[model samples]
Target chain A: MNKKINWQYAMMASAFLILALVPLFMSNNYYITILNQMVINMIVVFGLNFITGLAGQMNLGTAGIYALGAYTSALLSRNFGLSPWLTMVAALVVGFLIGRGLGYPSLKMKGVYLSLTTLAFSEIIRILATNLMDITGGTQGIKNIPRFRVLFWNLDTNVKYFYFVWTVAVLLCLLSMRIAHSKWGREFKAVKDNVEAIESLGLDIKKIKIRAFTLAAVYGALGGALYAHFNQFVTSLSFTTDLSISYVIMLMIGGIGNILGNIIGAIVITILPEMLRFLGDYYQITFCTMVLLCAVFLPNGLVSLPGRFRHLVKKKGKGGERFGQ
Target chain B: MEKKRYLSITLAMCLALSALAGCGGGQTPQPSQTQAAGNTKEESQQAGTAGESSNDTAEGASGETILIGVSGSITGAAPINGLRTKQGAQMAADEINEAGGVLGRQIELFVADDGGAQDTAINAANLIISQDVVAQVGPNLSGMALAVEGLLSQAKVPMLTGATSPKLVTTIDNPYLFRIRAADTVQAKLAATYATQNLGCRKLGLFTNSNDYGSGALNVIQEYLDGIGTAYVAEAHNTGDTDMTSQILKLKDAGVDGVIIWTDDAETALAARQFHDLGLDVPIIGSPSISTPQVSGLCQPQWLDNWYCVTDFTASNTSDHVTKFVKDFEAKYNETPELYAATYYGSIYILKDAIERAGTTESDALLKALNETDNLQGVVGKYKPNTMREMVHEGIICKLEDGTAVYLDSITVED
Candidate 1:
């Protein structure tokens, strides 16, 4: 319950710096570009960690929200007269409103019910993106998305895109950390742990849930905006049910309830395919096998690995209380 | 357990990274380079007329690296055609490179899989763009190409794709977007002209799948018919739709003289089967999508009777490039390359010629060079740009008979 500059943050910063230097070491520009994409996914995953990890509210509509953000920025900058900067702001605002609307329904739903509602909400958004040819450009998609540039850094180069995505990611990481340590963060945890008990405290559980949803949407939208500029195009296919499921699984694999875990999960999943390229068609099978193994055996995910290692080291003296402690 | 897991994870990571590192740099030379090196080298050498023609390419930038990007559905349902295009492009690049690299620079190709989606096509385009390709060969499908058109057009990167729609070529006036294949209107006009003028068929019944490709071709066909004041019967079906009994029944009731099939895959063949089951003796006229072997494989062999198809790529072409490309492609991929692959392959070669002629990767130079290309003896067919804003030229037409698409005739826009 204390705000501390912990070992976890140190590990995350180290990982961030190492990932930032990946493009430099790799001979293949293709992988370097793929790594740049992984960082973008990390941005979205970190946001997912906010609602799913800290708040314990399961929203599987990250892809929809991500698409909303991307399309919003794309439409505004390309169709309207607004610059990409203002378009991003519009994306966040719209994303927050949509998230809140979807979240408000969750007040009546609980657990899997809420998850289903979010899933349905994502599907509905996807259908609209596909069917509405006049507005969203239908399945043909909105094209000519502007390249991203922030603080005078043009994201045209692989290294530059990497820097920009990571800069935003790190900033989002710090912000989420700060918020997770705040009082509102504790209320979110309280609502997650026991809604009835939190209701008895009269702390307004519904309000906290909505806030968490809005926060998650804001993160998703920001990531989507980054994706739009990075890819320079927005279409319905980019945000599918698979992408939505991947976000949740990414959260789980990285370690639920751990900030660093989200980053690790994002990197692992994102980099896994690229790493498996040597196996060719067999690589996907191996990758799936590894993920399944982790899910079944290491259900606590990669985040708990370090703690488990520490526990084993100390368990030499005392063995019984290992899991409980 | 934790230490073992840690060590295992570390070992796993190292093994995976090393595996990836090993696979990193070994990709086949892309379409542009293969065409430039392989085809040109053979033609440009040997103190003869071919050598003199090769000298034209040799005089320019001859060893400079020109990277061209091609994005298509390489691993998805459309992989059959996508792989062929990739091969064709690569072969063209190899030939061009061997002939003495374009502008003294060897052409390199960077291809990405679109997975048959507009977003993926756009992603593939961006991936290629980040790697700094001079031109792009495809984002194969009309919808996918439309999605990425803005980026390529804005970047002023010329995209020479065998896209089938007039919409793709109309999106910009930037001269960067050029179609190697004929637009929909060209195919429609050819079909209409042939159906009415040559075949002496009248009172036609049309069965078309419900997609942009089908609808666009149908519209053009109908427009051509209307210009001739011909009243025709029509019906519509959807993609992936196997049952065409309802549409066929309606068309049969219309007392049609002949039937025209406008569809892309299984659905086209399904319509043919439905027509036959009903014992309808309607002479079948199919759109270009009906020319692929998959369509014939889907329908009964008897369906070939009175069944005619119009397409830009002739499976029966005896042209040197066409013959060699088809031979090489079949030898390598172990399958008869379809029109999609032929057009795509031709697009890659067309791009190589443009880039080489332009002598630089500058968008304007490439656009001008592409626009100036006249009577280019391409593998798909001869190409001559309209020099207009659209850059859409008339496409040649071929008719299918006995499983082979024989070159029936050609059409050019009248001055």
Candidate 2:
């Protein structure tokens, strides 16, 4: 068992090493830009995985959290002329508090009802951002957001941005993995699978669920803050319900309950519609069809497919004379 | 099984990447691509011994293929403007190409939809610049134009807009940015002067849309009014907002003899109808953008009585080019070309002429040609580049009589 754990650790480290090196070989500015977007999406999805995957909470208001984080960071940096790094920290803290507040309401509801409430919350936030023109620039959107350096790296180029976002994504993923495997993570699973049993054992199931959601919100908010800086702009359109749904799709497609799944899903979904651009107007329709087909056939999602396939191949090799091979 | 999974993943990735690449409106070639292609052509020209300095000749020859990029709301709320703009551009391009093309090469058009959104307009501008198009047209709305102007200025690509708002040019003008139409200030001054002089309208009330297009026109009118020491009552409404009873009530209360409206849709006609219904029998003077057939169609006969509007183009006008365009457009679309179409048509021609004059499709040369423009005849009127403060210069004021627009004298406003 210890040896098996060591192998798992080695694989995780190597996977991260590969992620860290992706920007080195990227060809053009456009590709690097897209990759940077994917990395930011990965961080957001990883946070979402905690809420939807671990705690079995269906919060469609992830985009609202993202917008809050983005607006908080941007307004702080732009209006107050504060350091953006400090603003990002502030955004995360605010996100954490808001998430806890929102999670409190969810304790009274569950399933689709909870999902609807979250969806309404996101919609409300989006509408407020749009209508409050004096402060939020209304529908014209906030522009000319100051670009900041990520850590010690100069993000003057897309290549630099690729490395910056990737580094953050990996670090967040590592943290998520550590939390996912911890005792609290097991409690989260307990709450998700059987809340009654968890409570019967005198465990604070509501506390676990709220903390998990709060943690996820923190992840989404930080990701949003990073995105606001990365793109150097934020509009109400960026944080619509469509974005939240897209994040859900990413989580589902990549394989819920796993960090690597979130990353893979983010990359797949992010790049999929972009690739469909050749189809012109028809691309969106085709993308929707593909997504529906995936949902129907691959119930466990795309992330687990490789591992499942490997398992199948090993089983087949043991059973037969390897006729196909 | 692992191999198959890998193959599927690879295929999926491949399909997605290709689709994204395909979404690009055109082959936006890099600067390196252009320079390399220029070198090969220059080498061939050098062998022919034209002696016009291959560099200069190459630049001129390259300019022959006039590239005009148009961006507008193609798939969203304002798809009509985008589609009509493209049609207008295509018509002009066809004419230029038929008449042996500009500078002996075919005119090419690259178009992208702004999605009726500001951010999309910025993206479209970047896309056009990347494609190395010499000049731009349309992006009809003021908000879209403002968002794109920054990128066009950065890329040094000349944008010949049809958007008439004066504020659209608020950013510092480089030699690269030029307008074919007169600004809203010019139109507002003309409308104000015409009202006070020709129509004997005094104590006017102004109604305009709440957006940049409407509000911008209102500002210009206010400035003109301030200049003339004329006091007027003003009210604003959204583009598609149907109710104007409150506005009409206010106008009635103000006891204004004439009401000037700045609108781009049937809402203007609706306002007129609402005005008549509310028993306010006042002469309405409207901005150029208010003269769409859709407006006339919505509020006709009684509603349109004594309605005056300033427009760059009139469907009834009998200029040779205008006549030909109307006939062709009528046959194709089964409707007369609106003023927006005419403006778009003119923009394409103006860009083509500038490209030919510059003798290079490069943005810098095209921009110079656009800036130094003077006395170029278009379907709308004569385009004097040096004097053009906006997309239009001299808007002809016309009055609606029996569902037909009767052209009055051209109103050219002083600065």
Tell me the TM-score of chain B in each candidate.
0.81, 0.81
Lowest summed lDDT across 10 adjacent residues in model 2 chain B is found at: B46-55
lDDT of 1 by residue, B236-273 (tens): 86555677788888888888887778777667777777
lDDT of 2 at A292: 91
| Whole-model lDDT values for every prediction | 0.70, 0.70
- What TM-score fits each model? 0.74, 0.74
Per-prediction DockQ: 0.15, 0.16
Question: Distance (Å) between predicted and true CA of B1, model 2?
Answer: 17
Highest TM-score model number: 2
Q: If you assessed candidate 2 against the hidden native complex, which CAPRI class would it receive?
A: incorrect
Q: What is the lDDT of candidate 1?
A: 0.70
